[model samples]
Target: MQSWQKVQCGVLLSISIAVMAGCSASSPYRDRAEDYRHAEPSHYELPPIPGQRDQMPIPQGSTQGYTGDEFIAPRPESMQTGVAERPPVELRKDNQGPWLWVNTGPAKVWPALQRFAEEKNLDVVYTNPRSGELMVRADVGGTPAQRFSLRQGVGRQTSEVRIVSMSSGQALPFSEFDRERMMALEQYLLVTQQQQNGRVSLAAQNLDDGDQVRWVDRDGRRLLVLDFAFDRSWGELQNLLSNGFDEDAQRLDDQDRSQGIFYIHYLARAERDSGFWSWLFGSDNADKAKAYRLVLTPSGDMTELHVEDASGQPADIQVEQELLDWIRRQLT
Candidate 1:
């Protein structure tokens, strides 16, 4: 009976072990994956791609395979350029003066400003103390200073703007200040022909079937005087046209605005004539009709000026490259 019992126990133990091994073989690899699910990176930063407008793309070409296990890169400093890599831009003529005044301050602090100005071939003016008021005076000393003025106690603060003259008989051709100012300034162009309290009519509105004015430069180059051209009242300086010119030397076919026009009336002065320019002006110009004769000084410059002659009007004028080149030559 004891022997029979031992045989039964041994067979039962062997059968239990066989049953467990069969169950393990029946299960799949997925069961093992669920058991190991605790691993994770959570989040990480990625490198930029090359060939992008803002960044470099990776792998040289995404279509190709990677080398070894991963790729290597060179030091960033070795591939990068400096902050000053970009170049400076040119400014428009009207804004040039103000812009330069601003940049000049920083220029005094920075070595690069001086170097850059020299490289671009521009003139730089520096003053002691660099006070704003003194700078304004210096700016106007060489050019027509009164044309522009400083305004304070308005809106945001103080700044510069052009002032208008209100002397013309409620009429004006051109003024930095809009229409209202132009009307006021028409007199300031100040036609010596007619003067009441120093206000003068500069030109007459006479429209003969065929009559015109010419744009002559200091050098005597003739430019086509468009319909807009008219004999404005000669300013304090008769040689100076004062205002009422559309564009500068480049006005051939383009519609634009120029700084201002200065009518020298050089020939009118040289030829000793005045009536010619006045008649083309008009009868409304009845009060403002005076002739100016511009004579070259011994230094080869104008001493006295006159307009109109016993013969025809001032030589046909035109705004040409030679004209501007010549005028700037004489003025500066």
Candidate 2:
């Protein structure tokens, strides 16, 4: 009995020790809860209600009454000065094409061209503003002749003056006189367009036409004009030539966009079919690839493209035309 009592006492002591250890472990959480419960409120204040004063006192003086009409501020001095300092309208000429483009519409250009004819002392044979056409007759070097056509260009806000010389009511081919007359008219109209200012007419802003490629004659040479920036035109030409040549036989040999030159390889079809061994062993009959150079020149807002052989000689007219036609189709 004595031994069992002793054992029971020992068990009770162990239980009390374990409970004390557990309480010590959980004391931190109880301390945290008590700290939160005793914390003071924050110091923030709510905003005052609109249209109701809480602290400010009313003024003692009499307030002014509102006028029936609202006060309107005057226009800024800068705006008035800007109107006086406005720059004159300037026209841009296409180097390859016989046309000029302006920001104003055809209505403005029509009157300007008419005024030009009057100033030149040319007889206005016919004038049609609706169709954007004008004809003027003048005597040049003792021969009575008429300018065949002076018309608005296909693009919006663009106009062209065709200087086709006519004698005895027959239209002649483009001549040196025609070229000089065209240049003179262009200069006169450019100056005239700059001086005039009025209400601009409403016309379709045909932005897409700015990118279309066209063929034009410049100094008796047929040149291809692309209405694109130089960088964009260069990239398009690279892709066009890359995909245009025979895939397996021909490839782009080299290109320099800054210099506006592209070198292309034209390998014979038979060379492509020959085995790798033939190429490695230097077969006597293996055909060599021919190289061609493409040159691009920027003319105002347009880029002109021309082709030549490896020897730096201009490509045959038919060859150049055919290549340009193919590129036009691809671009379209």
Candidate 3:
């Protein structure tokens, strides 16, 4: 029995040595916890320092904080009370029959033409806004294949649209077809103009008169001032004079844009004696249409429009004022 006890004690001692060896192999950082507990403290506590809670002083009349009723956001630099408005488009024809005019710029009209072409399913062959030209292939049902060319008007803010038919692969003047297309374009422009009339203002207003037209006194002569370029103003003036006056009573007989002169005829309102008896009586004293010249002179940014007699002399003050007033009334 004593021999058995000694053998058992040796086995127990070997087992204890094996277990300690296994634990030391698995836990290499076992001494780190003891080392940390025995280490000196690195950080020191700081004492509280007194300071003023309110360092910045508020202005005498200012509040310390925002009030509930105060407006927190800044005011806008500009206020938009309403959308600007533009005039309705007016379609007109010049003395030259082949060209038609629409009272809008090429920029606006070009897009509208594109939209029209798209709606009609016409294939656009070429389009150049810079050159103010468009060519399209019209192949609508029940109509022969055609090619159309649209050109912008001479003025910056106008369009002189034209169309041509394709015959034997060549372009030919399509007067009737051109008129039809022009009418259709006119309808589109009219609708768009009306729609945009409430949203955009195209004309620059004169601060002095609150109108697009103004008057200036230059070199002892009163001149009518138009807030448009020479080409546009000239076209608009021509349109106004042609349509605004009584039928056949007032007309522009001749014009030389290069020379800036328009020869106009204005007949008196009194009825002229006519027929065989009146012809036999010799109605030489009857009032006849007087010829006048409208001279456009560009001075810097604005164009000066002055009226003169056919002999190239300045019109009388009364005649000038009367014509100027009439034009102003018509334009405004």
lDDT winner among the candidates? 3
Which scores greater on TM-score, model 2 or model 3?
A: 3
lDDT value, residue 200 of candidate 3: 24
What tens-digit string does per-residue lDDT give for candidate 3 at 275-328? 588668765422466788888877666677899988999876545755676676
lDDT of 3 at 211: 56
lDDT of 1 by residue, 116-203 (tens): 3355343344322222111111232342212222221011111122332223223223334333432332232222112222221111
Off by over 4 Å in 2: 1-104, 138-141, 148-155, 199-332
Better of 2 and 3 by lDDT: 3
- lDDT score, candidate 2: 0.58
- Please give the CA lDDT of all the candidate structures: 0.27, 0.58, 0.61
lDDT of 3 at 123: 73
* TM-score of candidate 3 to 2 decimals: 0.42
Which pairs clash in the backbone of model 2? none
lDDT of 1 at 183: 33
lDDT, residue 331, candidate 2: 55
Model 2 agreement with the true structure over 30-132: per-residue lDDT tens digits: 5475687788888988898788865778868622221346634422222221112212232233323233434445656666666678787877788665555
